[model samples]
Target: MWLPGNTGVYLPQDDTALLIDAMLLAPIPRGARVLDIGTGSGALARAAADCGAAEVTALDVSWRALAAAFVNTRLSGRRVRLRHGDIRKCLPGRHFDVVLANPPYVPCGRGAPGRHSPARAWDAGPDGRAVLDPLCDRAPGLLSPKGMMLMVHSTLCDPEKTLVRLRDGGLKAAVVARARCPFGPVMSSRADWLERAGLIEPGQRDEELVVIRADRTR
Candidate 1:
């Protein structure tokens, strides 16, 4: 919540709130080990801790983001482990009872976000699957048997694609929540390009954000 100026850490937005809502409604088991991937302000991680999870691990690619997360979680009197690194490297053979994600889902144009740009928090490469695809591939392996994952992203990236990827990974996945949201500053700037790319209709200024729940039942 207290991200310092120019930190490039993501601020909690509609997508974050949406995911939290779904997470709160989920059936989190006792002694649940929850993993919050791409945690920005630690909002979701703290929310998971509020669920009385036995342990919460928040992973972020940006140290500044992790710093913000650490501060916020500590302020909430929650014991969330802050890890700095990409999930692909930070987590290997790791599993949790519940997994949460609100990764960058905005479709970017010719110039993708740099490592330090604030847009890095929201810009996914063309088609918006740069982050989502990897996350989907990793979700099944990240969940314990019968564990569940709740992820939120925009329809611009094709929610059905995510569902298929998760299902193919041996998980049952479906969209559980959706909210029509107006374009943000980034999207507004790229509206014309999105139109040209045929990803959105001309003059369409709103997109739907979806929360997908995936279960590893094996």
Candidate 2:
């Protein structure tokens, strides 16, 4: 976990841990093809490889994140193909039996706007769906039939919307795991904005993170 300071790479935090826990609990078929979206520190991808996935492709829009993942996965003695891109853009029409996601879901305020800033790892525009919505819209296509997707994000992004979108995409989706944790630095700074935007209540200091499992069961 030697993340370079000021590299704009996301550190493995609560959401990442939650997703890993959910992924481990799920029964990943032996020799399954797994794809880790926004691979960040590559933790989830490594876990998938260690858990029986024969092929694990970790994709991220930030090359820095991919670099972090490349180093981390190698350090863990896991073989994960690091891709410097995204699943939404079509990885040559590749489909995975398992897809892991820990995308940005925090509603970004004015302080964090630049695409290269560290906040890119957490900022998800006004409604926190800048990335989540797109991911939900395209996830079903990225998944193979009978495949399962494990995505972790904050409740601020409207889990109901995500569930509905996935279901609408012909996938069975549900919130499988949830955790209530205190607001981190980013959220702590956005408390006022979030309150004004009705994403959180006044004096609310904690946020709920949920692990949603969506299955493409044709």
Q: What is the C-alpha lDDT of each candidate?
A: 0.88, 0.87
Q: Which RMSD values do the candidates have, in order?
A: 1.5, 1.6
Please, what is the TM-score per model?
A: 0.94, 0.94
Clashing pairs in 1: none
lDDT of model 2 at position 210: 99
Model 2 per-residue lDDT tens digits across residues 41-141: 88889889989999999998887788888888898889999888755675967899999999888997655466566777788888898888889999878
Worst 10 residues of 1 by lDDT: 1-10
lDDT of 1 by residue, 1-218 (tens): 46665666777878888898888788577689999999988999999998889999999888778888998899888999988888776688888999999998888775776777678788888899888998898888899998999999999899999999999999999999999988877789989999999999989999999999999988
Off by over 4 Å in 2: 4-6
Q: Candidate 1 versus the native: TM-score?
A: 0.94
Global local distance difference test of model 2 = 0.87
